[model samples]
Target: MRRSIFETEHEQLRDTAHDFFLKYAVPHRAEWEAQGHVGREIWRQAAEHGLLGLEIPEEYGGAGIHDYRFNAVVIEEAARTRSGVALTLQNEIVAPYLIGLGTEEQKQRWLPGMATGELLGAIAMSEPGAGSDLAGIRTSARRDGDGWVVNGSKTFISGGLLADVVIVVARTDPEAGHKGFSLLLVEDGMAGFERGKKLDKVGQRTSDTMELFFSDVRVPAGNLLGEQGRGFYSLMRNLPQERLGIAVAGLASAEHAYAVTAEYARTREAFGQPIASFQVNRHALSEMHTKLQVARTYLDQCILGVSSGELTAEDAAGAKWWITELEWEVVDRCMQMFGGYGYINEYEISQIWRDARIQRLYGGTTEIMKDLVGRKLGF
Candidate 1:
């Protein structure tokens, strides 16, 4: 699809990003998957290539660009490569919590390193029992004189094993309902801030996911991300962008899967005739192509809505759930056309199929997204 949202500069950015992923990420897939995490060098290399910080201000060693299309381009490129690169989400999606809510002092202290890739950041919001229910988290941060002592654990956190700074969500006042929660920036080297074993997963193995433990870890009062008792509101404010990010990834992956399958159908033979000649295969391909085109239109509109500050949480939820579900569906059907070859790990289709599964589960489950949209409809 010829997207109208991007200009020549964005096109150049896409080309550059595609080249970078081809060079640094593609060749290292097997090694990273075996190790269960990507190398830290890739992070710094991304920063050096000007791919790490698109939203950070120039004063903070970033480009300071306000466009979300560029961010979408990055996500799309990551999906195209299927290398499970997630730094863009860390930088553009999660880091905004501090950018929007942190004090000037906090920005001055963290933004530069974050932009330069010297410090990797992660947000700790989900607990073992709390996947979609943000209010059900049991992590606690108790006031202790000038500092707050945090306790509890976060599971399935992106960059959990490697993050230099983790924005931890905890209940500061158990009785205050949602108002009791706060976000505390937990830095590395802090007492009782330990990481659990790296998790094994079915897909996106190059992306780090692990458990974080905070047992009486002391965080200064100044480390608070925003107003006391307003962390829930602050988090809700950024979710639209996160869901948009996921949509961007899903559509890109679907497109790649379709493109690959189309080529396979043309070359691979069945009964001495190219599979592309068969009516059934042709119809399936046409349907997938049509779905992708339609989904891309809605996704581009969502991107513009978000960039223009007009996107609602409900629209984002709709995009996240719908696009990701489509992504998995399209990829699975494409893989089926590949026959037994798709099941082998050596094939990119197999990897794409595995990687697409988590899109509906993470960020937000499809069921949770429906509930969110339902609530917006006054349900």
Candidate 2:
């Protein structure tokens, strides 16, 4: 399908992103996975390439481009290259909170380094006791004379291992219910702040998932993000863009998986004939192609809707759930076509399959997304 969402500039960015990933990320894939994370130097190189901070204002050392398509382009290129550097965690998830709510002094302190990749950021929301239920979070921050004393832990933090500053969601008023939550920035090297070892995960090992512990970590009052006791609402405000990024990643991964598997079927022989010549394989590939085309058309419309502020929470949730589920299905089918080779780690198809499983699980699970959309429909 012809996508009308991307302009000439987006294509130019796609080209640049594609080249950078191929040169810098592809060759490091094995080493990063083995070590459980990408090298820190990659971020500096990404900054040098003018790729680290497209959405940030140029005054803060970024391109100042607010368009979501630029994000999609970077995600697409990363998926194409099978590179998992967690760049989206920085650019897509954490950047918006700082940009949308940070005070002038806060912005001055953080945005430039974030743009230059000197300061890595992560948002700690999921606690051991709370995944999607914000009300259930046990991480508490008590107000001190001039600062807030934080106490609790976070699990499943994507960029926790190397985050220079973490935007932590903590409960500030036990009696205030939804209004009780607030965001606080906890910088590295703070006393009693500890990071657990890198988690061994089924996939995305290069992305650096880790556990974080805060024990009476005193954060200055100046570090409070947005309105105190409004972190839940702030999180809601950013979900549309975050889920949009997830949808982009899912679609790109599925497309790449299909592309590689289809090419393999054409060249790999069966009974002295290409496997793709078989009716079953041919029909499967055709179905996948048609579905992907439909998905792309819908996704292009979503990209435009989001950029223009017309995309609703329900809409973004639907896109995230439906598209990620489709990605899992498409990759699984592609793996079937590869037979035993698909189960082997040496083949890229196997990696795609492993990574695709997390799509339906993260950024709010498919079940949660459906419930959100369902509730909005009065169901």
Candidate 3:
């Protein structure tokens, strides 16, 4: 089914993003995967093309476009190339926090570098003991004489090794329970702020993920984001968009897998004929195509809802888990169709399968999303 949500300008942007990825990311995938992270040069190239900071105001050297369709285009095109650069994290997740909550001075200090890819951003929320339970975070920031002293560690922080600045979620008043959390800006090279080794992952090998440690790191009072004691609320408010972005990427990955597998079935022969001629393969393809179409339609609706400010947390959760689960299922079936060849590391289907596993686990697990939606339905 054709998607109707994007305007002509969005298609043009998609073309630009596709060309940029093909030129910069596709050829370097092997090297990047070997290094366990993409090079900063590609990020700078993307910034040159106006791919970063779409939400930042023009006065701060960003595109200043608030539309989500542009973001969806970048996600889709990046998925098409299988680039594990984490651009969605930069544009979709972290940008909103800064653009929505940062003070004018903070904006002036950070937005330009963010827009130009000089200052990459990462949000540190999950800890070893706390993944979905935001209120259980133990990272603490105590009030000091003109600054706050932060002390804690975060694990599984994407871009941790390369992030120029990290927005650390810390407990400001342990007695206040959930109301005690606040966000502090912790910059690179700050005393007592250090990054641990890059983590080895099952997939998305080209994206950097690591541990971050902060001990006695003093953050100025001006580095505080939004109102104190409202960090949890701010995270909740931005999660819908983050989940929607994940859903879009999941749908795109499924679609790409289906397309490539369909072509492979038509060419790769079994039983002295193309596998696509077999009833089982034909039925599998038909089923996957139908499922992907349905996912795309629903994802499109969610994107529109988000763009129009009508999307709810429950709705985004539904889209995230359902679409990502479907993505994993579709990719798994596609891999099976390739038989022995799909098990090989050289095959893209195998990588897609590996990468799809993490989608259900992150941005809130599938179980967590179901619980969230169920509660919203009063179950």
Candidate 4:
């Protein structure tokens, strides 16, 4: 099905983003995977290309475009190239919090570097004991005259190793439940702030994921984000957009997988004929094509709704889980079509298959998404 959500401007942007990734990211894939992270130069290049700060205001040296379609184009091109770097984590997930909630001074202090890719940002929310349950977090911050003392640890923090500043979610009032939580900005070189070793993961090998520790780190009161006790609400408000991003990537990856497999089936032979000509393989391709079309259509609608501010948390939950689950299924089936070659590391399908598995797990699990939707339905 043809997508009508993008205007000519978006298409033009897509071409530019595609070329950028092909020229810079494609050749470095092997090295990045080996190093466990993409080079910081790519981030700087992305900033120079106007791909890093779509949400930041023009005064802050960013493009100042608030539209999500432009973001979708970048993500689509990245997925097409199978770049495992986490541009979306910066632009799609963390930028909003900074843009939407940062004070003018905070914007002046951080937004410029973030836009220029000179300062990388990461959010510390999940801990070893808490994943989706924000209320279960045990990281605490206590008032200390002109500053706040923070002590806690976060695991599975994406971009943790490279982050120059981390927005840490911690409990400011231990007895106040969700209302006690707050967001504190902890910068690099702060006393007692440490980043753990990069984790070895089954997929997204080029994206850095690590553990972060804060031991009696003192953050100035100026570093608090939003209200002192409204951190949970802020997190809730931004989650819809984050999940939407994951959904967009899921659809894009599924489409890419299907396209690669379809071409493979066309050329690879069975019984001296193209395997795609066989009824079983043809049927599989047809099923994947249909699934891709349906997912794309729904994803496009979600993108439109999100861009216009009409998307709800429940709706985003539905999109995130359903589309990611479909992406996994589509990639797995495409891998199977490659027969023995799919199991080999050299094959692109193998990487796609490995990378697609995490979609259903991160940005909230499929089971958690369904639970959110169910609760919204008055279950």
lDDT of every predicted structure (CA atoms): 0.89, 0.91, 0.91, 0.91
Candidate 1 clashing pairs, residues 3+ apart or interchain? none
lDDT per residue for candidate 2 within 333-363, as digits (tens), equals 9999999989999999999998889889788
**Tens digits of lDDT, candidate 4, 242-264:** 99999988888998999899999
lDDT of 4 at 288: 85
For candidate 3, the 10 contiguous residues with the lowest summed lDDT are: 80-89
Please give the range of 10 consecutive residues that has the lowest summed lDDT in model 4.
80-89
Q: Write model 3 residue lDDT over 1-379, tens digit each, in one string.
A: 7778889999999999999888888999999989999998877889999788888899999999978889999999999888776798889888789999999999999999889988898999999999988888999999999999999999999888788899999999999987999999999999999999899999999988899999899999999999999999999999889988888889989999999899999999977999999999999999999998888888898888877999899999999999999999999999999999999999999999988899998899999999999999999
The positional error of residue 47 in candidate 1, measured at the CA in angstroms, is 1.3
**Model 1 over residues 243-294: C-alpha lDDT tens digits?**
8898999999999999999999999998999998999999999999999999
TM-score of each: 0.98, 0.99, 0.99, 0.99
The alpha-carbon lDDT assigned to residue 125 of candidate 3 equals: 97
As a whole number from 0 to 100, the lDDT of residue 43 in candidate 2 is: 91
Tell me the deviation in Å of residue 39 in model 1: 1.0
